[model samples]
Target: MDQGGAPPVFSVTAEGDDDRVHVAVTGEVDMATADTMFQTALREPTRALTLDLRAVTFFDSAAIHAVVRLSQRFPATLTVLPSAQVRRVLEVSGLGEQDWLAGR
Candidate 1:
């Protein structure tokens, strides 16, 4: 969730396979969308997650925190495929090329 109780809704295009989920987020991921996306990942038993952020031009710490927390939950097994903007956020937040991202 970002702020104002607006949780991120998934525009999930394809069905997940082999514990690998392909997600395309198309909105702001501030505090509002944080936990929604986080739970979407955490609740899944997927071994790998590829988040396509091509449509996400805006993101925030809470969103990054969600990813980082999920990465920790998976123990360096989170596979993130983010856009440049999201990549920058991850990098600046000290999550770029970490063990988790390294596996992707």
Candidate 2:
């Protein structure tokens, strides 16, 4: 679901099962939508969680922060699938290659 935000915010689709939860995100992600993403991503209970950012067109520091926070909270359960552009930002933010970002 796309949580309404200021402008150019992102949409999130969350799918969950017995062992895992998957969230696919599209559009831009920034301060306007970071909290929404965080809330939506953590709304379910699962042994594993995957964040799919393949369709994201823009990612900023706030998006990076959201990923970091989720990683911290979920520990071994969180995974992030970032696009090339988002991967670059994650790398610059010192998180792209982290094991915590490994996707299922």
Best by TM-score: 2
Kindly report which residue pairs in candidate 1 clash with one another.
1-31, 1-32, 1-33, 1-34, 1-35, 2-31, 2-32, 2-33, 3-32
All models: lDDT? Answer: 0.69, 0.83
Model 2 residue 95 CA deviation (Å) reads: 1.2
Q: Can you give the lDDT of residue 44 in candidate 1?
A: 55
Per-model TM-score versus the true fold:
0.71, 0.84
Which tens-of-lDDT digit does each residue in 21-56 have in candidate 2?
998998888999878888888888777889998888
TM-score between candidate 2 and the true structure: 0.84
Candidate 1 lDDT, 30-60, residue by residue in tens: 8877777776665556777766666676789
Where does model 2 exceed 4 Å of error? 1-9
User: Where in model 1 is the C-alpha error above 4 Å?
Assistant: 1-14, 102-104
TM-score of 1: 0.71
Global lDDT of model 1 = 0.69
